[model samples]
Target: MEDPRTDGAGSARREPEAAAWGERVARFVRGRVFPRESVLDGGGPEAAEALAALRAEARAEGLWALPLPAALGGGGLSFGAYAELAEAEGASDHGPAALGSAPLLDVTMLARFGRPEVREAYLKRLVAGEVRTCYAMTEPGVPGTDPFRTATRAERHPDGGWLVTGRKWFTSGAAGADLVTVMARTSGAAGDREGLSLLLVPTGSAGFRVVRELPVLGAPGQYEIALDGVRVPADHLLGEPGEALAIAGERLQLGRTLRCLRWLGQAQRAFDLMCERAATHDGSRGPLADQQLVQAHVFDALLALRTTRPLVREAVALIASGRDARTEVGLAKVAAARMLQQVADSAIQIHGAAGLGPDTPLPALFRTGRAARILDGPDELHITAVARRVLRTYGRAG
Candidate 1:
């Protein structure tokens, strides 16, 4: 007898092609790539080499640069398709970067504002994994949520060049990056947000220095960057002065979407692990899968996952359809990030003491989930924006 779930009646509910690709990626990672539990935590030159090899293999497999446009050697996936890939990669701790699947928040900015030559030179290399770049905007003393407080400065030199001077922190991927995309104040515009410009500075250029590879929570990778007179040709400037804020705004919107996609991936993995553990444990006399409380927690996590999936998908679709989803993207980011934290915490609860041990993946998953709330932007900030938008639309006083 034909199964009802496989018949034409259920064809409309078939899994997405993205899911199939995601499953392939997951299988490859679990079956072939990830080292055994003995060698998962530390970062070293050897780990870096292994990661690079994996990246090269992923690139070779026609899975490289999934977020990039088709003309640039990417899969030419729409936002929805790319989001699914991100979710898949996010399922494991190093899977995203190892697969060359880090969020390309500025891809839209590059497509819209970059010069033809700039796109050809930089974006093409980015797609090919020949170069890695990190964004430098946040400063040591400046409030991250306040963009107007940026202290980086760029002055036009007499010889048609620009000299940039600044210090930035929490610059992820900068340690191994070939280029740094810097935002600097280029003019004496009245407001803090005005007169900003984006510049591409090569790694070995004079006056550009990586001060240190920061150790965050004992994990190494993020870098502190110092631009003590970094000089670049006029052509290195990404867009006109005074347009940096707009570029950053657009990039953040897309970044939030990517964050949501990545978080969804991590949450999915955590939920799966929790369920597996629950089904097999015999210490409680009854399987955890049969516990009412455990079931409730699992159901809640699944509900959040189910809800946020569509929001993320919709945001991706809207972006691909040529609609700017700034506000919607923020909401999605906040929702997914908060939900991920809840899901991870619940998984830890379901796993009991095993969740706290380094041997289990839950601890690492929890750390990553915690970082998501602070990455891109804090959830409080997004909640504030969401509230303001709602008030303006529905408030009687308005």
Candidate 2:
């Protein structure tokens, strides 16, 4: 049977040419990136040189920017098709960046809300991998994941610009991003959701600074940044003033769904490694796969993977159909995050001491699995939100 994950598009849907494209992506990453991740992660000149070569290879294969719109020079794959491709691309940590598809979210957002000049300046370069960007919404004093408590402020300048002042943290990719989209309070009082606005700040601006590259759960690249009286041109404002939430909502809906797809891929990769170990490794009594205890672990891991796959697909299907999938996404987010963590634990236990070492991918996968629940809104927040949203159906006030 065709794997339902790739085939779930139904008979009426387009042929999942992605099954072939995805295989190509997987092969490229496994051959080019999977073996060189350590050098890339080391942040050395050799890593940069290797990455440039790998990216060039991806571009040569016409694999660059597969996630954006074809009109924007992307492959124009549907969310479903991209989901298949993303799963394969995600098996390696550097796959998206190496393949020139890392800017999908930023490009999509800029295309929707940027002014003509802003679009002209950054859109094409972003699709072509000439630049990179990050979104900064989390602030130090605010309640994490609660944008209503945002303290960053952007005051309009008299000469067609704005003065942005604030400190932000957990801004992913900020260390290397050329432009940063910052969510700040531009109108209304603190805690007023409607007053928030997003502004584009060039990293080289006068008062913009990257304070430090945050070491999140032993992972780098996340950063803390400060913007003190940073002046940005008026045209850089995204969407309308006092309406950042709506634009942010659109980005998050798709962003969260894509993260779920990638998480599924990472989990599947770990599961494969775990099974490979079980089948081949010698144990106290023989092959680990021959042991009943190890059999239980394999059964449980497969069960979790199969169960979460459909819930995530349901959310992806709803979002692809342009429907509000808050509940579906929330459920999938929690399930996929926990599933990855659980499966990683099982994989580690099966690998014994080898799991925690650098020789295996389990340690890295485990770290990401642990961070997943917290990064895209913590599991607690999603659980409460999903419960509240679901309870509202029976006329119950959550």
Candidate 3:
């Protein structure tokens, strides 16, 4: 398919295709994912089976991994085009996993930097959903904000393979992953920026072990892992030695943008729930929608959602075009996270006790909202990073 930005006419043509796909994904999420959300979120053999069934159905309907590269057995939608569908696909937390888009970051990274053998080994299986992967970067007792201080190290064995040693916590999806991409220092001291590299380790490797599950806001996915001299072949190294930071930076640019899109979807759902309750639920005073305070919640939530969407879209466009997008992504990440929390809080308030209970999805939505701020490098990090980048331009001008 032609890149829409390559020509004037292609831009108009791609819009309808993306819109149509977005609608299909949205419908699937509503019909398939929403109904099974409780089971999917519960995390067990039953949840795994339900999720696998959903994946099968998604694949049968031709809705699996639309955003992934076509060569990798996906629909091969461009990032910009996929941005249109991401919101719908991410409405429920399980949407990405069910629809086969969850491994996007790992797939792309391995494809770009993996040795021919590494790609041959895992890329196709990964795209085909035959396996699962997780990323381990943050460590327990260490501030994830400062990755340069990572204490994990990978030493070269006599055979020239790598033996990795360290611990990582909050590694999402680690419990079931077939492979894990680890960040470890190959040559630098703990505080040095250079010499860090990424290595692909099979979960079944002798020394690799999952220490424990680390629940986030009561959700079951994150894990603490220990890599005690886990060995990997020389070719499993991603990019050049000391290139981990560069590669991770590129990955995060896209990851944060995708997250912003998902947060917007969640926020929109919360807003809808808030509106529905206000309109239909009649309290002692009258319909909640008739109350002035309830109206305030609706107005504020709508304003936030509207204002944050454009920021996220701008970031998506920039990243899709392969330009530097740090400033835009940071702004969108903070805004979308805050918007989700604010909107979901209002939705829960409108639902009263029912929102906090298992009867409604408000609590789950709110939990995500609360966690969004901390995950992917908290709001303060983005706020300061964007500010620093902006101020640098002024410094250059002066």
Q: List the residue pairs that clash in candidate 1.
A: none
For model 2, which pairs clash?
none
lDDT of 3 by residue, 1-398 (tens): 23312122334434459889999999999999999999988889999899999999999999987776666677677778888999999999999999999888888788788899998999879889998999999998889899989999999999999999999999999999999999999996999978899999999999999999988989889999999999999999999889999989988888898899999989999999999999999989998989999999999999999999999999988887778899999999999999999999999999999998999899999999999999899899999999999998887443
lDDT on C-alpha atoms for all candidate structures: 0.74, 0.85, 0.90
Highest TM-score: which candidate?
3
TM-score against native, each model: 0.88, 0.94, 0.96
By TM-score, highest first, what's the ranking?
3, 2, 1
Off by over 4 Å in 2: 1-16, 396-398
Q: What tens-digit string does per-residue lDDT give for candidate 2 at 256-363? A: 888888888889989999999999998979999999999998999999999999999999888777778999999999999999998999999999999989998899
lDDT of 2: 0.85
lDDT of each residue in 1-398, candidate 1, tens digit only: 11111112222222246667777777756654556322434666667777777778787775665555556665555555556567776666677666655635545566677777777777767766677788988889877787677788889999988999999999987977888889888887424556788988887898888899877655666889999998887877887878888878777776777768778888887898888888888555587888889999999999999998888887877765657676778778878888888889999999899898876677766777788788777888888987898789875763
Could you tell me which residue pairs clash in candidate 3? none
Question: Whose TM-score is higher: candidate 1's or candidate 2's?
Answer: 2
